[model samples]
Target: MLAAMRTFELSPADRFTFAQRAAVLSAAYADYFVPLWVNAQQMEAMDQIYDVDARRSVVAHAGREPIGMALLSLRGPRGWISAVGVIPAWRRRGAARAMLRRLLENAAQLGLDEVWLEVIEENAPAAALYRELGFSAARELLTWRYPADGDLLPIPRELLQPAPVERALAHFAAWHGQPPSWQREEPTLRHLAARSSAYELWMEDALAGYCVVGERPDAISILDIGLNPDFGPVKAGRTLLQALAHRFRGRAFTMINVPADDDLSRALAALRFTVTIRQWEMRLPIIAR
Candidate 1:
């Protein structure tokens, strides 16, 4: 009797062949509660922004057909895993494990001090896998959504002032406690500077909060929104978001990765924003020295 031979191959993703990547991501995330709303072009653009290197992907194949995929990116000493998925029919056949193990190995070889990724809150299997792979949860983030047409009261424009990039960056940095990974260093500065418009909120003639809007062709993404800790959560958060929505009235808006516990969550809910999804940030340290 001959031993059974496992049939699968793992290879780097080819940049020119994004159709494959899109197919896999779409299938794997089809049931996802809060979809990233990514398309082929968006995936390609993300690869460009992150600068896809050879160590960035592991694609599992049986014969010539792709069955699983994992994508990684280097952010300084941190390794960021963006999309990792195995086709439903291929699940539990070692595809996900193989790809993840390879990604971790690649991260170690690249001298990354830590690896991090986000998981949807309801994804128990994925969360278990991450924990089993030595990754730990760092924080919880919320995705809020609201109908484009909602009864929102108009906010006074005078309460909102344009925020200078420098001022916005400084305010974000000085936020109490640990800031989310996206708000750090280059990424934060880049996001703020790249925004179509940024604003500072004022209440009782004092600065209360700020927000930056990333305007897309069809919708506006609330990239970053924060309130001064001293301003008290209820008043500051409500004022800031109301002012933001007022600024973009008649436009579709969505916010990605807002902290679940933040006061903004409550305000948005009150304004009829639906809690679309919950995401968990995970990290793994790679460099010991």
Candidate 2:
């Protein structure tokens, strides 16, 4: 006989079990284009920020075996659903749909007016599921990366200085044309402030642009970069890239997520950044009844 599946809210006190379930789902969902793994440290950080009342975990059980799981996080007004997966053997049993429905209900109860998520471009099943739930295509995001070969540009290094937090925040606020839900706002700024280093590019003693680089064990991730839209994309991007490379010589970089169609994307491509994968940013607007 099979036990009934259950949905529940995971509190901070349930850290141990939460971590275990998160790891299991991450492993089961890891695919060629969608790498959804999270380490213990990252999980701890997530638990700290994700509102327990808004977050949920659904587990489908048959007998004593766990067959499927899903996780959601509420960041400010946005509810983010991530790491939804069913073990290969247990797929096609409606577990995914049940988990998603429960998550959406939880999001509504939490007073979130919107929900957002990302699906790998190649994941048709996941994309279809989101579409059925009223998620529409917002934009396409890409991850670009380049190897660090100790190559250095001849640009003067004096023009670059460490970015000040206040200035970086102001600059990010002024950035336009990015999706409302996709903008790197307070939380992202806070994360960047703690885990990354920034550099300000100066031309004639004026701020031309700025870039933030986040260092990880495997690669240096370019978290954010903004240039004066007037400077022309190619020149501005090259200047930022050269400055970044000079700052961290001999270190490889992997831009985890960036706009697929942005001017910066073209510049990075010109400098030999290969497209690793593409993802569709999906948005669901919670209409008031």
Candidate 3:
């Protein structure tokens, strides 16, 4: 099986065909959660200058037919397993494992300190596979579908004024609280700067909390939110959330990858947020060969 799998490093933006990539993703995730449908706009967005380096995306071909792929996002000492897929016909033939192994070897060669990925909490088989490959459970992340209407009474606009993107980004950089998953991490936020809107919550002259939300088309994705660790996560989360709730009144939203045990979860619970799904962030440390 391994002999039939010819691996090729793909520079997706330059050489690989999008339709082929999309086909593999769809087939691999046939029974998986929300199978990917890579639309034209999404493809254009992917081509934009994000932290992702196309050369790290690997494709496995069985006699010129793409059967598996693994997408990587490089961030200096940190690397992310953004995606991994194996078509239905390739499953159980060791295609997924082979593709992953090749990616890991290449990641190590790139001198990354650690490589990380997230798996659905209920996916026992995938989790076990990752553990066997040296990945360890790091933290539980929650995906919440929050539709609760917050206090309708208006608050001081000054308290939740628009903040400088750099200011919010700096606060994000300085945060020492719960470790964030890929979507909420600094690299993703930095890459999304231009399209995301930023805001900071304040108490008098002190900055208490901040958030970055996706604008327009995807107004529901709360990309990142945080507060001063010393100020208290629960209080700040509520305050910040309240501001957001009022700002986006009657509009529904979904937040992803929030630490399950953190104070923010308590705040979310108080707001009647429902857990849509849960995921586990897995980490693997690397030593160059």
Best by TM-score: 3
Pairs clashing in candidate 1? 113-286, 113-287, 115-284
* Cα error of candidate 2 at position 149, Å: 3.5
lDDT of 1 by residue, 1-289 (tens): 1113357888887632677777777776676664544678867866755544534688877666667788887667777787888766777777888899999998888887888888988889989999999988988887777656767755755467887765765677654334554433346446347544678988777777877777766577776676787887666777777777787776677887766676777777777778777889888877642
Error of 2 at 225 (Å): 1.1
Task: Assess the local accuracy of residue 148 in candidate 3 as a C-alpha lDDT between 0 and 100.
Answer: 41
**How high is the CA lDDT of each candidate model?**
0.72, 0.67, 0.74
TM-score (all chains, Cα) for each model: 0.80, 0.81, 0.85
Selected candidate, larger TM-score, 1 vs 3? 3
TM-score for candidate 1, residues paired by index? 0.80
For model 2, residues 142-246, the per-residue Cα lDDT tens digits are: 888777663455455545688666576577655533543333444555654766777888766667788777776546887777777666656777877877777
Candidate order (TM-score): 3, 2, 1
Number of clashing pairs per prediction, in order: 3, 0, 0
For 1-289, candidate 3 gives per-residue lDDT tens digits of 6345545433232245767776666667777875676754564465342355556667777656677777777778888887788776667766667667877887888888999899998888889888888999998999987664534534435457787676798977666377677777786787788888888988767888888888554346788887887778787787788788777777677888888997878888877778988989999999733
Highest-lDDT candidate: 3
